[model samples]
Target: MRRSLIGGVLLAIALYLGAGTLLFAFQRSLLYFPQPRAIGGPDRLLMLPVTDQQIAVTVRPLASSKALIYFGGNAEDVSRSLPDFAEAFPDHALYLLHYRGFGDSTGRPTEAAILHDALKLFDKVSALHSEVAVVGRSLGSGVAIHLASQRRVARLVLVTPYNSILELAQRQFPIFPVRWMLQDKYESWRYVPAIAVPTLLIVAERDEVIPRWSSEKLFAQFRSGVARREVIVGAGHNDIGGRPEYLSLIRSGI
Candidate 1:
């Protein structure tokens, strides 16, 4: 019985190490959900030069001084949101990022790469427009928090935002050593404290992906006077944008 118990313990330890190794190797695959552009394509696709590669962006360009840089959810094609955004803010210019591997962008997606691309997009837009606002949804909220922390953003909006992807992964895989295993931690909590711009956090009343606690925790991290939280009644994590109040709240923030 003692020998059997020893064998079982060793087997469990081996499995744990193997699982962690696998998680580290293909972690980005789990974190990013890339999709091709929908239908006929965007109004205008912008090519951005970053390091050795060029990333793509869908632009609803306007000759305006105020612009909005939008980062979309995992599995979302940001080009689809352009029409609605164009109608909502007719006077302002819009630039929707097609994350590294998604849409027409080249190369694999990673947290570090996405964040770097976001900064590049902002800088490019800032030159053409005097004021630049940022809006990020779901997984993209993680990108927005990091961008806001490092840049001087005019306005910031996060829809279905979470405190950190690491916390969510830990909750979902309670048995696994997510802290040590996961690669793209996306700890938005570490970035929120530095975001000083007037920010709005929109939550789904029934967000199945992100817990309400996660949103609340992130909201609480923002500088006292710079943050606002709004919940759309009867909305889910993905359907928040469909609500009439969604655009209204976003317009009010900017």
Candidate 2:
């Protein structure tokens, strides 16, 4: 009986150690995917005023229309959506920003850095167009909320978003002390109350990454009475842009 207990204790210790080690190794991948390769397409690079970071702004060159600024998912090359956004809003000017680390953009993508970039890009877009709207998906929703709160955005769209990174981490690693460990706090729910723009919160019913409850929670926090719609339907967290409903929602705003 003593021998069995000793063996069981050793096995338990081994399992605990192994789990902890694996978690530490794959933590970065869980947080971000930093790929800094040149992803070329049919878009001109427009350098924002008072910053070294040059944004690859793709415009579908319309005669007269509004402008839409789209923030990409955490692991996406937001530029790929340029063609579709251009096609969808052919009349409206479309701009897709490459986050600090994604595509050929310089600098690292931190919460503060992305917020500053959004502010700078908003200024640049406002200068060229009369009406400006912001669209953010997944991680980008955090950026969209921040911009909506500060900038004069005519409309805002958030797709498959979370309340905050801290809340998300808590869900994934319930045992781990993530509140103190996490560095990027993409807190969108906190900023939603301050935004007075017409907002559309889109959620993927079958989202495997972000829970539907998170988006619902954010919607509940919004104080703005300016036309808010919650789209709960098809498409996963990553492929939300391909959905026909998503395009229709944007078109309705335009």
Candidate 3:
């Protein structure tokens, strides 16, 4: 009987180690959900040349000094938002990025790659427009915050933001050592203190993906009076864009 008990313990340990190995190997697959571009044509798309890869940006061209750059959620098709943004901000030119591996962009999505692409896009846009506002939603919030820390953004908006992707992963996979294995930490709080531009955080009252506490934690990281938080009543993580006040709040922010 003691032999059987020892054997069972050994089996459990082996299984746990195997699971950890698999988690570490394929962790990025769980983080990025690449989606195809649903809208835009050759005329409306801008092919941005990066290091050995051409990134696609859905653009609304307007000859203006004010511009808006948008980063989207993991599974979002950023092209879909172009029409609404064009109508709302007629005076401002719009550029919405398709992350690496999403839409027509090439290369795989990673924390470093996405942040690098964001900086490239910002530098290109800021060169054309004197003032630029940045908006990011969900996973893209981390990318946006990091870019804002490194750039000179005129205004900033984050929707359904979180303190860090690592925290979320740790909460979801409590059995795994996520802190040690996570390749893309995306610690937005680390960049929030560096943001000197006016910022707005749009939160969903009933966000199921990112907990309200996580968003509040990120908000608290901002220097006092540098950012404001707005909650959309009866909104969830995925459906907050459908809320009546969503675009209006964004308009106010940028």
Candidate 4:
């Protein structure tokens, strides 16, 4: 009986260790759902230097002094956003980033790599434009929050944003130690206090991914008078773009 009990204990420990190893190895893979280069036609795609490889950006370039830089969701194809943006902001040049591995961009996706690329992209846009507005949705909210805190962003908009990927992950995988396993924490709450630009946070009325409280908590972290949080009546995490109020809020913020 003693040996059987000892064997069961050992087996449980081994299973736990194995699960942890797998979680650590493929954490980023679980987070990033990369899609193929969907923005067809040669003219729509633009390449920019990021490390050694040319990162793909969906550009709606105009000879305008104002530009808008959009960082999409983790699994988003930014090419789809071009039409809506062009209709809304005709005078502003539009740049939508496809993260490494998401489109034609090379290398694997990582938080450090995406943040590095965002900084480079923002610098390039800033050189030619006077006022640059930034929009980040879902996962991109983390990138946008970080960029707005570091750079001179004119206006900031986040759709279905979270306080941090860490907190969200912890809630999703309650049995696991997500805080220890996660490689990309994406703690937007940390960046909120330093952000000085006028900000708009659009929340889904029924967000099935990011909990409403998580966004509210992040909104609360913003310096006293810097941000306004609005809710879209009938939208979820992915479908918030379809809401007319969502676009209106974005237009007003810009």
List the candidate 1 regions with Cα displacement exceeding 4 Å. 39-43
Per residue, candidate 2 scores C-alpha lDDT tens digits across 95-199 of 777777666667667788888988988987888888998998888889999999998898988878788878988788887666766678787878877888788
- TM-scores, all candidates, are 0.94, 0.83, 0.99, 0.97
Name the weakest run of 10 consecutive residues (lDDT summed) in model 1.
37-46
Candidate 1 residue lDDT tens string, 51-120: 9888999998899999999999988999899889989999899999999999999998988899999999
Quote model 4's TM-score. 0.97
- Candidate 4 C-alpha lDDT tens digits along 25-134: 98888899987766556787788888687788999878899999999999989888888898999999999999998888888889999999999999999999999999
Give the top-scoring candidate (lDDT): 3
State the C-alpha lDDT per candidate. 0.90, 0.76, 0.96, 0.91
In the range 1-254, model 3's lDDT, one tens digit per residue, is 99999999999999999999999999999899999999988988999999999999999998999999999999999999998899889999999999999999999999999999999999999999999999999999999999999999999999999999999999999999899999999999999989999999999999999999999999999999999999998899999998989999999999
Alpha-carbon lDDT of model 2: 0.76
Regions more than 4 Å wrong, model 2: 1-28, 35-43, 49-55, 58-65
After superposition of all CA atoms, the RMSD between model 3 and the true structure is 0.7
Cα displacement (angstroms), candidate 2, residue 107, comes to: 1.6
Clashes of 4: 0
Structure candidate 2, residue pairs in collision? none
